[model samples]
Target: MEVATRYARQVAVIGVHSPKFSAERDPANLAAALERHDVAYPVVADPDLTLWNQYAIRAWPTLVAVDARGRVVARHEGEIALPDLLESLRPLRGPDGFVAGDAPEDASGDEPALANTLRYPAGILADAARDLLVIADTGHHRLVVASLDGQIRFTLGDGVPGLVDGTGDRVRFRWPRGMAMLPDGRLAVADTGNHALRLIDLGAHTTETVAGTGEQARHRMSGPGAARETPMASPWAVAWFAGELWVAAAGTHQLLALDLEKGTLRPAAGSGAEGLHDGPLAEAAFAQPSGLAVAGGRLYVAEAESSAIRQVDPATGRVRRLVGRGLFDWGDRDGVGDTVRLQHPLGLAADPDDARPILSIADTYNGRIKRLESETRTVARVFGGGDREQGEMGDEDGVGTAARLRSPAALAVAGDRVFVTDTDNGVVRVGDLATGRMNVLRLEP
Candidate 1:
């Protein structure tokens, strides 16, 4: 993205998106994703993977550089560093060197107005005790605090994409995601795009950078350093467990731990490898673990890439898979143990009142809210997708499966109300567990 912004005139970058899941094949879903990520370049949807076959692409993000004459100049199979990519493109320059063209027009002007205040909200936290609903308004780069009754209480950040820290509207965050309340009542945020963990003092209306160096970590296995000194790769979600902050470092494929009292950061689990391997903490591998929840004295992880749910014992330092088969095994099936399948679930919320270990999952790609019973090892759809065709998602509100959701990214359970971050729809869908109905949360400014 930085490269595209820097050389927008000299280069023409086009994104070719190949669908990985059934829901991703939808044109509306693809457009929402592009807009949520603030994509400025033109992107073509390759629903049938025609471009993948033509380009011989074997990875989700393979970059093929084409010259001015439409000749393939260079190819990168995986994520390439900005400096490395810039160096490789130097060969395309002519003898007189590349000339800068006029600045590109703002593509955002063509986008439709959002239906509500929130735009691509990603993560949510329901504090039933405080009667508060905290939402990670991702695309807007801010945190919204709302009362349980849908009234906006307050907000953090200045609604600008930045990493600056200050008070109230002066503070800034870049696409912040998951959030957890500290023991002292402060809120901790996984400032994803900034690669930092931020602390919000709600009482004082102040925000501070507690962890990360404001730069993406080049090394996946770096840690055991001071909290402010450690460079972190995109920390997607955060959970407070065992008197520490557990971070799903998605970009590095590892779980990180930050001890607030000790002021130190270190790797808690994973081997920095992207796959589905469970065992000892140091040997276990995670594929883009994006969501996290703590319950029953264990930490639950939502692996987006593998479409799997895993549990980690903080005391034993062991990791185990609860559902999903492997990296390539994914769908929308409900059953017991290994028979159950999920399609890129991204958020989890523990049912506080349930004596049995139960979790509410935001099945992002499937556009459904599922309930997972750890004791019985059973998964079932609680909301969205009824008799409708598979992969057909919408924004209609109805009873149970009759309701429709579009790429629900994260959810939070408060009492009997399930607050869902309807990401692609840019709205929060509140579900009634008792009544089996769902409705859009109307935010009052």
Candidate 2:
């Protein structure tokens, strides 16, 4: 029998995040229990645990009952008997207002949000030769290349801002992200913090201006920030595919493909906008597009605000929804099982072997990365769901002081080696793909 006579209304609520309320975690026959009682309201199938991270779910099935006025009159944790559930409602009919978590400013002047930080920040991947691993150190505003053993092999931007490093003397990158090794082993960077993308020389440490002709915000991207009529505006993510480099322009809402040899870009639609496209790809635009990757002629993009995963038809430049609707709902923190709503996500990649064509997404806000199977979109792996700086990183380092991740913005994988930026920790961390284990690269001053 349905609880037809029970409470029924759209109640504003907040709940826990991913780590504590993982979807892959078996519910202990919770669904059967709910069904036995005929309770419904779509208790929210949040596989990624977005609500768990948001409300900081202290207790399982914690209850916060709000009155008709949107105030929380009663909050009970654990299982509340029906009589008590009704007893807690007495305040709703009274004069007392509901209780809200809104509080006064904290002592440090920092607004309180999630109670976690970054334990790992950067992820690394390699080329065909495993000659190098690339990292986008956004907070530091630089792109780093390291050895297989994690040594500082090379650094780009020279700690200066500019598209061409010393060539222009003014082409600086702001919050740089996304790096790809071209067929020739050259590196392409999405300098998000700087509003431009640069191509770096792996051997010489020289920076080349590839797009967004200017170093600042510009609506049209021609070549670099210094150029006119270019389409790049705050490019955040990049990918190399079929002899072309693709950039996800977060500012102007577009996907740009560049000829690595020619360094020229053309707008790509992936899938036509709205429904049917009768115009050029440039006519189509992405909404807050953050991360991009390509495999088997298909393009996968992560739109943060839209909270969706989309597939791009490379032939027509048309884009279509593959996962989220960009609504920020609760789902998967990683792309492994079911995709989840995110706070902000910034990385995407497909396994190179073509055996599975699996895609990996770094669900930054939920503090983990998820792997999804190809085309079918089933989750294959989920890791790093607890992205807080716990004062300690990598169990092997033994710094174990409750360290959590700060905000991991990017990721890269080669073999079983994974890398993280540890944005707040101000160092790059390393992990093993086999055991889901972690170790710090220790990039501190």
- Compared with the true structure, what per-residue lDDT tens digits does model 1 show for residues 1-445? 7657767767778899998877788888888888888887789899999999998899877888898788888887765566677777776877765565554553432343232488889988889899898889888888888887778888887676788989887788888999998899999999998999999988898999999998888768554999998988889999998889999999889999999989999998999988999999989999999999988999999999999999998788899999888878988888898998889999998888545789998888888899998777799988996664354478899999889998898998888999999888888999999999999999887
Question: What root-mean-square deviation over C-alphas does model 1 reach?
Answer: 2.6
Q: Which ten residues in a row have the lowest lDDT in candidate 2?
A: 109-118
Cα shift from native, residue 282, model 1 (Å): 1.0
What is the per-residue lDDT of model 2 for residues 1-445, given as tens digits with 9 covering 90 to 100? 0112223332333333223323224352235324322343455655666765665566545777666776556878654444555566667643543333333331221222111121222434555376576666443345556665655565554334334564222334555677777777667877764566677766666676666655444343333322223635667788886667887876656677776556556765523132212234555445567788777788788776555667776587555665664343544433432443444556777767665577776665444556766667665334554433211112222121123444455666666655655554455555566766666664321
> Which residues of candidate 1, in runs, are more than 4 Å off?
93-116, 388-391
Could you tell me the lDDT of residue 296 within candidate 1? Answer: 90
Q: Against the true structure, whose lDDT is highest?
A: 1
Instruction: Please give the distance, in angstroms, between residue 240's alpha carbon in candidate 2 and its true position after superposition.
Output: 1.3
What's the CA error at residue 58 for candidate 2, in Å? 32
Q: Estimate each model's TM-score.
A: 0.94, 0.61
Score each candidate by Cα lDDT. Answer: 0.86, 0.54
